[model samples]
Target: MRTLETIIIGAGPCGIRTAIILKEAGVDVVVIEGAAPGGKINIAPRVDNYPGYKMISGPDLAAEFFSWLNDAGVEMIGDLVTSLTKEDDLFIVQCEHNTYKAKSVLIASGTKEKKLALPKEDKFFTRGISYCALCDGHFHKGQDVLVIGGGNTALKEAIFMADIAAHIYLIHRRNEFRGSNKYVKELNDLPNTTILTPYIPVELIGGDRLTGVKIQNVETKEERVLDVQGVFPLVGQIPNSTYVKIPGVLDQWGTIPVENKTKKTQVPGLFAGGDILPRDIRQIYLAEVDGKMAAKAILAYLEK
Candidate 1:
């Protein structure tokens, strides 16, 4: 078991930002990441909202952040944390490869992509269904693909796929898109993309591989089948807090309730930030702010 002053349980913006602050303050800390460092941001095709950068690809921005982390000399461990437990005055973080003991712990695990609960959706996962267009779009070059959802993610995925895929079917349950005007307009301008509004996915059609999808009109009971080789469901995200079973800490939505200013959780010495923290605006800039706030609060708590 390794002992540390603090353990940050993610390598996303929040965790990386927190590590930078703590390291600059001369505090000992280590970051643990289950996958590659970027988290969900890696899948985003383009990010236009984050301040300081006008229009940058998600992977590029993530690379810049990782460069900063390296310059700050923050140590990162590549392992999945299985459980976190409070033991006396210390916190025990159990990972797949190692165990860590720390005076304080920060849970910034972020959110995981939500899946469309259509029949056989799980069976076709990564076989023909995907959540990341940037990651899987190349596989379907010049092929037909269907995108689900009406939010920014869905629109962005469609826009990204329009370049690689021969034709894209953008499906949404609502008549209007909930994404930004710029993205919606960009998607509409694409010649290879077709928008299907007021429709819901009924079933996936294929065996061992995805070949088509069954959809229905929300207003009317009319159903139709789309001949597409791939499907990308960009609906929404859920908090990655299944391993965090601390009673009275998580809300009904499985998000951590923390002070807006301090980012301190109800549990002593346990903090949360980023998407895992309950907040209406879930953005990378806000996640960075949460990281700074949590770092300051953790430093203050360590002094006492």
Candidate 2:
């Protein structure tokens, strides 16, 4: 049972950035990650927004981030944090493998993809229905696939699958997409992509594996079935803050409410950053900023 100065959950961009800043300031900090170091950024195909690089793939950016972390001598542990409990002045973080005690904690677990609550969705999670097009798009190469949603993620997934899948059926509940104009234009330019607007998914038609989907037109209430081997639903995401249950801290959306400047939550020693915070815009740059602010606040608290 090694007691640490601070424990940051999730080694995504937010956690990684926090670790670098704290380590540079001579703070004892450790980052706990469940999966890979990149988090959700790995699922993205292209990222043109982050400063410095005009256009770079998500994996490449993630690699650079990891390289910086290594050079900074930041410690990262690969483990899934199950829960966080406060015992007197110290916070206890319980993971599947071990438990850790820390004076302060930063929650940067990010968000998980939201799923379509259609029938049999759980039965075919890995069988044919998927959320990440980059991860499962190769499996549906040269075959018809369906992409649901109208956000940036959905459009990106459709565009990435366009090259792999023989035909891409993009279904959206609204006629207009919420993604950027560039992505919408790019998706429209692809001859292999078919845009279906004002349509909602009714049911998932398959047994063990997904074979097709049943959708209905929102206007005329017309129902139709699209034959596809794979389905990628990129609707939205839910914050990963259920593990840290603090009364009166979480809002209605389950996001931790934090002061924008300091990233401090209602609880004194607890802070939050990244997608887990109740920020309108969730981006890599903003998450990095939040991490830096959290690290500064923690360092000040430790000094006091």
Summarize candidate 1's per-residue lDDT along 1-304 as a digit string, tens digits: 7899999999889999999999999989999999888678888899985778888999998888889999999999999999888888989898888889999999999998888888899999888898899998999999999999988888988998999999999999999877888888888898888899899899899978999999999999799999999999988789988878567888999999998899888889999999898776678988899999999999999889
* Error in Å for residue 245 of model 2: 3.2
Query: In angstroms, how far off is 210's CA in candidate 1?
Result: 1.0
What candidate 1 gets wrong by more than 4 Å, as runs, is none
Residue-level lDDT tens digits of model 2 in 39-92: 788888888867898888888888888888899999999999998888888999
Q: Any residue pairs clashing in model 1, and if so which?
A: none
- lDDT, candidates in the order shown: 0.90, 0.89
Minimal lDDT window, size 10, model 1: 241-250
